[model samples]
Structure formats: structure tokens, C-alpha cells
Target: MKYFTVALLAARGAASPPPPLPAAVALNSRKCRRSWWCRRRALGGAAGGGRMALLYRATRLKDRADTHVFTFVVTRSATREPDRDVTSKDFCCSHQRWAVAFSRTDASLGVYLVWRGACEGMRVYVDFTFTLLSRDHFTANEGFSGKQVRFSAGCAAQGRGRCITLAELTAKFADARGEFQLELTMSKVRTLYSCELRAPRLDTPPIAFAGFDWSVSASGGNKEPLTLRLVRLSGEGQRCRVRYALALGEGERRLHSGPLECVCDPEGRTPPWNPRPPSRILHKGVRLTVELVWARALAELAVSAAGRAATCYDRDKQAWALRCDTHSETVRLHMLYRDVHNVPRNHLRYVSWSAWLVRASPAPGEADADELPGAPFEHYYAQESADEGLMMETALRVEDISRAGCAFLHAGGELRVRLEWGDTYLLFQATYHVYDDLCRLHAHQMRREITALQAENYSLERQLFSYQKSLAYAQAQAGEPVGAEGTGRRSPAERSLSTDTEYA
Candidate 1:
């Protein structure tokens, strides 16, 4: 039986020699011959003696593919040198050139699949497997697999850096010609929907992808941290995952966020990304690359109005006034921007503004305010020359504001405003307070003024204390009395000045 196992191992092209039979199998030879089950067990023991090379081959064969097979060989001379890379000849797959690369660093073997096609700012999604084939080509000694791995200009290769050790490859996987063989099987190779924009406009025209039109927009000026957003222009009830990579300014300093991942909802919009470390300023002509990695259909989402109505404070009417058509049902909110600069007769100033309306707690007895059919929105006005005398006005809308639990009359509402001009950025926030009449408004203003005066008075008191300490220190150093007659008491004129300072 041991000789038969050796013969089988030799026929299967196993590199290792067969082992001796176990004592139990040797002693039970008569019983093994008497029963079919015993005979089968003896044969299994024989196969195990040969290291089960047939089973190994079967398992490796299950993973091997006939198509997109790229073979790379590491020559003996190359394996002797550490830090040597032996790459295979280019082969075409998915209409692009791909090759297998084998590298040796110290004593470790690294395997990678290299992309040699024209980059053109594209990202490829590929499913691949790498197998270190044995000398006989019937079994794999080591393997690595990757699923949905991304390959782009920045990342042109994907695989395992430590697929196998050099000593193990030399001992087990090297062929009779004294070379290590590696096989790569690639499948499901496809290009993702990618787009690049240079010096993007406020709203770029829609580009079609996967039966949907998508557009990108840029906000924030050259001095501000740039914000980029993706908006679906045509498709409805669709969802997708996107990856965005940004390079700011002419130097192309990549954002540390790397490939920012965003999930776009059925509304076809992704949350705006303001790459952090606010010190990274976005210049006017930056580059942005976006790729749609995955997408799927979603259930229908509720339709809402997309129109914006302009509103401003009317000086003559003493109330908020909408400047655009009010008949639109979507006109549920208004934003007013008061210009800080006064304009001369024919002069104009460029000031960019952005505002957000954050809803507060629901009104009394209203529990479903958050569920009321309204979408959060932001108002943005670009930097264009405008008369400084005119109040900068923009508006946003929310659906079903008149519904129960959706009234804006309650307190706790917050209006956040951002103003940018040249290299300056200013942020102002105001909390909503309800006033029933003009008298209450006037009282509120007076109370605010009193609070400001109190703050000023406290600051003045601190300054006076500091000044008194310095004067006393100087007098003491000069051997003079800090106060009148060294009694630590101020004279009548000093007392009067202190009293006046306290009141002021």
C-alpha cells in the first residue's frame, strides 16, 4: 500500500516524497483486506501519506480561471537580488493593458497587478485573484484575492505586498527551470463613471452617466475653504455612492481626506464637502475628480419645489417683504441680508453671502414637526458686483410649512450667515425671538444696549485696577506713599474720579 501511495504521488507530480505507513494501518492489513470500508480507509491513509496532493490540486483548480490569466515568472538570478521586481509582459483585458508584477524585498515575495493603460482620469473597478502556482501547475501554494478593488491614476496597481516568503517560494513553487511562477486571474473588469472639472463654474452642465444626468457645483471663493457638491439633474428615485478627490490651487496639494466617500440619496444630491484643516485655501482654478462607484434604484421620493424667492426687510413698510412671485406654494421661508457698506453714487462692491435656516423645536402641542414635509436648504449668493446700498437678499423654501407642527412662529430658530469678500470671512448668527408689538421690539433693543454697556463698564473697571497697581508699584519703588499720607486712602479728587469712572 505504501508503494502504491508513492506511485500515485509520482503520477500526481507532487514534489515531496511519500511518507511511511502508520503502525495501525500496517498491523491491520488482514482486516483492511476483509472489509470494503477498511480497504477504503487504507487507501485514504495512503493518500494522506503522499500529503493529499490530489485534494490540494482539486481545491486550487476550483479557484483557477481560464480567461484573463496573466503569468509572471521570477528568474533565479532575479530572486537572488533583494529589491528586484520582475514584471510580466502586457496583456489586454477589458480593452486595457494589464500585467502581473513580482517583486522580492529582502526575503519576502510581493505580487501585484499593474495597470498600463492611458489614465485619462478614470477609475477602474476590478475583481482579481493571484495564485502562486506550483512547479507542476496543478496546485497553488499561496493565493490572494481582491474584490471590487479600485484602480486609478493615483493608484495604478493593486495586490498583496507579502503574498509569500522568498524562502518558501524557492523551496516549494519554483519550476524545474529554477523560476518562481505566479498566476493572476482577473474578472469583472469595468470602468466607473468618472468626471473631472478644472476651474469649475458655479453650476456645471449636467453630464450623463448610467441613464442619469449629474452635475457638480462649487461654492466658497478663492480665499475660503472650497466646498464641492454633486447634484443629480435628471434622474429620480436613484441612489449612488461616489468618491471625490480634490486638488487645490496650481500646486495640486491633495486633500488629506483622500478619496472622500459620499452616498447620494434619491434626491440626487450629496452633502457638501468642505475639506478640513481650514488653512488649506482653495484657489480659483482648482481641480476636482468624482467617480460613481456604485449605484442602485430607490423607492420614489416625495417631490418638492426647487424655486427660491428673494426677500428683504422693507424700510418703508417696517416689515419683511418678498421681492419675487409669492404665488409659488414652495415659498415657505425667507432670508434677509443687511449690507454693512454704504455705496457712493456709482460704485459697486462684490460681496458673497451664504445662509442656512435651522429649524428649532416644534410649537406647543406639536410632536411631528420634524416629520413635516420640508427639506433643509441653504441660500448662497455668488460674488458679483452689486450696489452696496441695496440689501443683499436670497431665499429658500420648505414644503408644507402650514401643516400642523411646522409653524415657524416659535422660538429657538437660528439663522446662520456667512459673508466673504476678498480674503475676509465673517460669520454672524442670530437666535429667533418673538415680539408681539413694536414696544417689545424697542425694549429688546434697549436691553441689548444695556448689556453691551455693562460689558464695557466691566472692562473699564479692570483697566482702572491694573493702572492703580502699576502706579502704586512705581510710588513704592520711589519710596513715596502709595496713598495719601501712606494711609492707603485716596484724596477727595481721586475719590471723585473713582466715582465718575464707576458710573461711566
Candidate 2:
């Protein structure tokens, strides 16, 4: 009897559910203002309501040594307590920089851009200006020593990673007169900018490699030298083609390579090929590898993955992380590797900025620990974070997709590079600094070797995949199997690899 009565009541409840979402309710109206905050409060909600994710807390030690500009921005992160001191620990890899923010009391929406180094040495003068006509949209440009950089912005509503580079950053709208009405915290996204300059350390080399490589890529601390190197190009003076890569910790990785052609070959006019650059350069502990390969057209590339994690490589399949461009004669690759660390907790000791060299005066609008004036732990000086770092700001304009995670300017070590083109040697001067990660960042042409090797590796991996796939397809049509285990396959390398990774 009781069950029958309960069933009757349940049927009555279903007959009358909540009224249809006000068919055509006016937005920004008080009639439904109470529910507005309730609806969009979690994901990038309006001001005061905007969140500074746990991983992106402010550097709250209180500035004294120098008046460094500080901003509040939050990069998307998985961690919540980012402000906890992470002394001597590795920096977070998921996001290398801080997502800057501006408070409601703030009057401007720009980087505080604090300069910090031991003893206050380098002079920093920023003259670039940007206009935020509306949310997720900005436009600006700057010229540094004849080099022009671009700026761009895009709405995340379209989707994540849909970025607009420097040119596109400022090209979207021309009517952005002044600033748009932004809810101090909500509309103020974690913004970054890049400017062209004469300093080498301030900018990344045209090519680079990131993450862990058997052949460690060099780091660029402080200001880098004007020239870079291609390690040992002992191609026997042969017109050889190879590749390289660039990494910027957490952003994008770029792989670029060209014919390191020795016009006057000592051995012969045409050589077989240069010892292939390493495949390690093509990876950063991740699965994506930017490969620049020169086929009949240009280089080609692709992100690699299979069994377990995305980057797990399979020697048996001859599968590696990398891609290639179709229009170039050379290939360079950077395997998006597993990022280790780099987070806000890494910067807790910076109480004051030395005159200029040692520390930075916390500037408002500046958010990333790498951008602020802080010492790299006690031994190294980790400058240039994903959100901060003057040189990092410069690279932003170039849209250098590579080395977005691995490139940075230090403040303590001497940044330098050595290059050799058949004994025609050249040396470049680079200011240096120790990174919080304890890895050495090279400041010279040494950057080329790693980048080049990664590119070559990606190219080789691609060829191997194409070859195997085609052969397998052809065999299948011919009623043949693939691989051992009655699969029927060839290639000693593939069989040797112990993992079950797929080239696809």
C-alpha cells in the first residue's frame, strides 16, 4: 500500500518540472542577476568572481629591496597551492610562466616589467604600448634595434591553444581607441608581449631543442651573444642537410633545419650525408615532436604516441617523436617532452632586488616568478619564466613556436656560444645564470647542435614510419602478414625495440 502511494506522488512531480529557461530573458537584467553569477562562476566568471587558480597565487612577500612591478594572472594549472615555497625543487612543466593579473584597484592593464639582476647592471627601457579593445583581444607592436616583433590575442571561448601571434595579436581590430571596460579581475587575462632587440640573450636562437637530450642543449642567461654555433659540422666539407629544434619550457617547440652545404667541399663537391642529428633533440619527455623534413617539396612532421604515455617511443616500429616541413631541404625537430617542473613556489627567497643585477623590484601587473626579480634558489639564477623574462617577452613577437619551454635568460652565468664552419671559428659572448632546475643553459651556438639533431631525428623517424606503413599496406593487399608472431615483418631495428608502440 505504501509503495503504491509513493509511485502516485512521483508521477505527479514529473508532471511539473522547473519552468522552461525564461524563453527570451534579457541579459544583464536584475530579474535574473542572482542566477547569473551562479551559472558562470566557475569557468572564467566575471570580476571579483574571477579565479586565480591555486597554482597561480600572487608573490606575497612584500617588495622592499626594489619597487618591482607586480601583476596578478593565473595560468591554468592542476595544482592549487602554488605560492608555497618550492626551494631547490624543479619548476612545473605543465605551465612554465605565470598568468598575470591586475587588481580591481589597478588603473592600468600591462606588465609591471620589473628588472632584477645582481648589483643592478643592465639598463631596461620598455616603450611598447598595447590596447585592449575588448576581452580576449589586444593589439600592439614594438621595434628593437631594427627587428620588428608582433602581438596578438584570441578568445578562449573558441577553444584552448587557438593563439594569435604578434602580428595577429594586434591586427584583429583597428578601432580599439583606449581600454575596454573590464571587471578588474575577470577580463584581465594572463597576458604576455614580445619586442625585438639587439641582445642575443634577450632573444632565442633561430633554432633550438628542449627538454632532456643525451646531448644537452645550451642555455642562454641574461643577454646572449649576437652569433650562435652548429657544434661540430665535420661533414667532411660535404654539402650535408640536417635539422635542429627550439623549446620554451611549456609553450610550443619549433624544429628548423636547412642544408649546411659546404659550397667548397674539401672531400668532394657532393657528400653522402651528414651524420644524422640525434632523435633526442626531437623530444622533451612528451609525445609531440616538431619535425622539419625536406622531401621533394618541404619538411614534414607529426606528434607521436602509442601504448602508455604520449611520448613513449618504440624502436621496433622505428617510431619517434617528430615531423617534417615539405618546402625545406633540411629537417629539424623538437619532441614535446615530459615537462619536469617550474612553478610559483620556486620563487620565495627574493626579498629585494639588488641595484639591478641581483633582484628585481616587484612590478605591478607582473605575475610569473621568472619575470619578477628573484634569485634562482641560492646557487643558480632562474630568470625568464613562461609569463615573464625580458627575452621571453621578445620571443613572443617572433611567434617562435619552438623553445617556448626551454629558452630563457639567466642572470648569474656567462652566456656564450662557439661556432665552427670548417675551422672558420667564431665565438659569441652571452650573459649567463643558473636555473632553479640545476640544468646548465648554454649561451652560444651550442644551441644549434641539439636543435639540429632533434630535427634530423624527427625526419628519420618519419621516413621509417612512411616506409613501414607503405610496406605493410602493400603486403596486406598481397595477402601477406605484418610483424612476427605470424605477422611476418622485416627491419632489425623494429624487432629490437621492446615496447609495443605504434607509429601512427
Candidate 3:
């Protein structure tokens, strides 16, 4: 349960890759507020121009500053490290000013990032929502849906990076309209030292933000997503909230189907939709990539009773994530099948990636026609809008064009991974590959040389055996001239080389 609280809390604060800034980039977080939010205009799409929100200003930690803390309601701990599930009747997110930041003077990272809040009374205890442990390994959502946790949390200091996605949660949060009901109470609390809310974006190259057409595209310039993360405080007579806001010149939004997660107007009238994003991508410490592949290749897959499948598996172990592959005439697809493991609990294999061509490969003659002007192409992707978006462009060779959506394709590329431990971030490069003709040709030639060597060796042995027999017979005949039992005489061909020629 403690672990779950930690994970969930971390998951919400996760960040996407910040845009490229010129000078030394510092950790900076701002308030998520009505004014700082994008403003609405009469234009067709979004228009950016909103007031900027104040971020947590640097402050030194004073001696043992007054603080408050609380446990989560209906939360479950995981045997796994850095992950937890919490069930709370309600949870709230609010934007309140935090005076101090992470530094030697204040609370440490371990103490700062926890499920806690404070208030004014000398001694105060608030009945905020929290998850309680009952008996063994199971969990209860507490009549609510959505739970989340973070994994491998410790590192942020030594470059340990993190990315966490939480299942949707419902909490009682305050509104910008100053609604008292939504307003959590905190008073007389001294804001001293706290962990710096702002995190610097490592020179980590941004991975392709991938298909948003609602392939949403991020302008290397403006219109990027920004977010601020804060803590909530509540006690007998006092309460305060930390705020998070989205950033600009960074991330993107996508076309979505559900109601906006943001609060709406109270009048039941049209909500003030100040230039909202279709979707915002998280690309910071951990970069996420989605590869949409066809189903046929994944058919023979042995899905277990737990909805988990793998060509090979670990015993009684969770099979939520498995790397498997299938080669079909249409396209060979490799999948990272996931069970109900991820925070969102998506059913279909999580991150199913396969390579395929949308149109039949250009015919032999059409091959030249392909590079022709404006030759449109159908791309192999999961349910994507018309203009497919990709952070990185991948090139694939076409196989049979007449096949269904699921077809075998050949694709190879380089993978850059972002991993963090403590305060340090580690990057790894893995190159995905498919056999090329040159490699195959070299292999074939090696096989041919081996075969030729074997045959020549066999022939040489046979010739040596026959020659030995003939030489023995000739020597025996020479030993007896026409009838002598033991006299030896050299053969005419051998005589000149070993013995002097007789004149007579």
C-alpha cells in the first residue's frame, strides 16, 4: 500500500520531453490557472496568448518548518518495487502557491513526494481519503474507478529518470472559480524548504511524438504542452494546494472522444474552452512509442487464461508484457502484448507494433512510378486519422499488396532508450534489423565453399588408395623377372630417376 501511494503519486507528476532551449535549461514548474491557460479566440483552431503563471520561487528551508502528512485511502501495495494501487472515494488537485523549493534547507525528495497535506491548528488531524490495508494481496477500488502507481522511483538525483501513467482516478479537487466546496483548507502553515518541482530536460533527444493527426505535431517553436505538479494540504483548520500547468513550445494535443479532463463552466452553458489541446504527450524521462501492426501474425499466439500470451513464458508469473513475433506473407509483425497491467488497463496487446504497407507494393514497372510526383501511399498503422503523425519516419519495403490489413513487412531501425536510475540518466541504442541481400549472399557463398572442399577431399582420398595398389603390384612384378621368385627390378618409368642408365 505504501508502495502504491508512492507509485501513483510519481505517475501523475511524470513529464514529457521539454522543447529545445538555447542556454542551460533549469527545472521550472508553474501554476496551472485560468489566466495562464490558453485563451479562446473566434478563429477556427487554437490561438495561443495567455497570462503566464508563477512557478515555485526558490526559498531556503527553515529549521523544522510546520508541515502535515496523511496516508492514502483504499490503496494496495505491490510486491513489485515502485508501483502501488490506491482506492479513494475522492481525490482533489488544486493550484496553491508553494514558497520553498528542493534544496539543502528543506525536506528531502523522499519526504516531499508523498500522500500528505497540512492545516493551521497546533495539532490537527483531517479525515482525508486514504487506502487501508486489509488482510492479504487483493485490493478494493472503494466504489471508485482509476488507480495508479510508479515503478523504480528512487533515482531522480543520479539521473534516474521516470515515466508513470496512472489509471484514471476521481478525487475532490478545488476549482479556479474559488468554490469553497472544492477549496481544501490549510492555514498558518509555514512554507520552507521543498524538493525543486522543476526538473531539467536532459539533452535527451526527443523521440518521435508519433501519430496525432489528430496526428498532433509539436512546433519546434510554440504550442507545446506544459504541466505543473503540486501537493495538497489539509488539516483541522488549514489547507493549501500545489499547482501544475502545461508548457508551451514543447508538446502537442490530439483528437479525443471523451469529455475534456479540465473543469467546465458552472452555468451549464458552454464551458470556457480556452484553446485546449486535442491531447498532450508525455516525453520526458521516458519516451513512449506506439507501433500499430496487423492481427493475422498475432493469431497463432497462445493467449492464456489470463489473457496473456507468449511464444515462451515464465511460470505463474505475470504475463502482462511479452515480446513476440509472427511472419506472414502480408507482413511480419512483432508485438509487445500487455495484459491488464498498465495503469489504463488497455485490453488489446499494449504497444502492438508491426510493419506493413498500405498500398500494394509498386509493380515492377510501378516501382519507378512510385517516386513519381504525388504518388499517395497507404501506411500500415492502427486506427489512425487521415494525416498519420510520426515522431520518426520509418521506411518499409512492400510485399504482396493484395493482402488484408495484416501483412508481413520488413523493417529495420535504430532504437534510442531513455532510462534513469537516481539522479543520473542512462541512454542505450539498439538497432532492430532484418536480413539484407548482402548478408544472405555472404552466407550462401560460405556454404558453397564448404561443400566444394568436402567433395575435393573425398576425391583425393580415392585417388591415393588406387595409386597405392598399383604401386605395390608394379614393385612385386619387378622383383621377379618373368619367373624369378624374389629378384627386384625397377619399372622402366621409375628406372631413369632412381638408377643410372646402362649403356649396354
Could you give candidate 1's per-residue lDDT for residues 118-141 as a string of tens digits? 354566778888776654324234
lDDT for model 3: 0.22
Q: Candidate 2 regions off by >4 Å?
A: 1-106, 112-209, 212-504
- What is the Cα-based lDDT of residue 72 in candidate 3? 23
> On a 0 to 100 scale, what is the lDDT of residue 282 in model 2?
19
Tens-place lDDT digits, model 2, residues 340-359 = 12212232212111111111
In model 1, the runs with Cα more than 4 Å from the true position are 1-67, 118-120, 136-140, 196-504
Best by lDDT: 1
Tens-digit lDDT track of model 3 for 72-170: 211211111122221122111111111110111111111011121221211111112122111211132221111121101120111001111112111
lDDT of each: 0.45, 0.23, 0.22
For each candidate in turn, the TM-score is: 0.28, 0.17, 0.15
Per-candidate count of clashing residue pairs (backbone under 3 Å): 0, 121, 81
- If both were scored by lDDT, which would come out higher, candidate 1 or candidate 2? 1
Position 5, candidate 3: lDDT: 48
